[model samples]
Target: MTKEANAAYDSSWTFIFAWLLLGISLLISGVRDLYDPAASAWTTWLGFISSAVFLLMAVNGMRLRRRRRESAEPAGAAS
Candidate 1:
C-alpha cells in the first residue's frame, strides 16, 4: 500500500486497539470488583476513568483519520 493508505490503516488499527484496551480494562475492573466489592470500588472507578480516556483517544483518532482522507482527495471533489 501507498504511504497514505498505510497511514489510514494505522489510524484505523489504533482506534480499534484503543477500544480493545478500554474493554479489557473494564472487564478486569469488573472481575476485581466482584472479588472484593468494597475495597475494589476505587479501582473500578479508576478503570472507568481510564476507559473514558481511551474512548476519547479513539474518537480523536477517527477524526484525524477522516481529516487525512479528506486531505488526500482531489481538490475538485465534492465535500
Candidate 2:
C-alpha cells in the first residue's frame, strides 16, 4: 500500500485495538467488582469511573478513525 494509506491503516487498527482492550479490562473489573464487598457508594463510584474511562477511549478511537479517513480522502472528490 502507499505510505499514506498504510499509515492510516496502521493508525486505525492501533486505536481500535486499544479501545477493545480497554473494554475487556472494564469487563474484568466489573466481574471483580461483583465479588468485592466494598460499600455500595464505593462500588457505584467505581462503576461510574469505569464507564467514563470507556467513553473516553471509545471517543478517541472513533475520532482517530474519522480523522484518518478524512485524511485518506482525495481533496477534490465529490461530497
Writing each residue's lDDT as its tens digit, candidate 1 over 16-79 gives 7667766776787788878887776776677677767766765776677678888878999965
Instruction: Go through the candidates in order and give each one's C-alpha lDDT.
Output: 0.72, 0.63
The top-ranked prediction according to lDDT is 1
Models 1 onward score TM values of 0.63, 0.51
Residue ranges of candidate 2 with Cα displaced over 4 Å: 1-38
Worst-scoring 10-residue span by lDDT in model 1: 3-12
- Top candidate, metric TM-score: 1
| Model 1 lDDT on a 0 to 1 scale | 0.72
RMSD of 2: 4.9
What lDDT score goes with residue 72 in model 2? 78
Residue pairs in collision within model 1: none
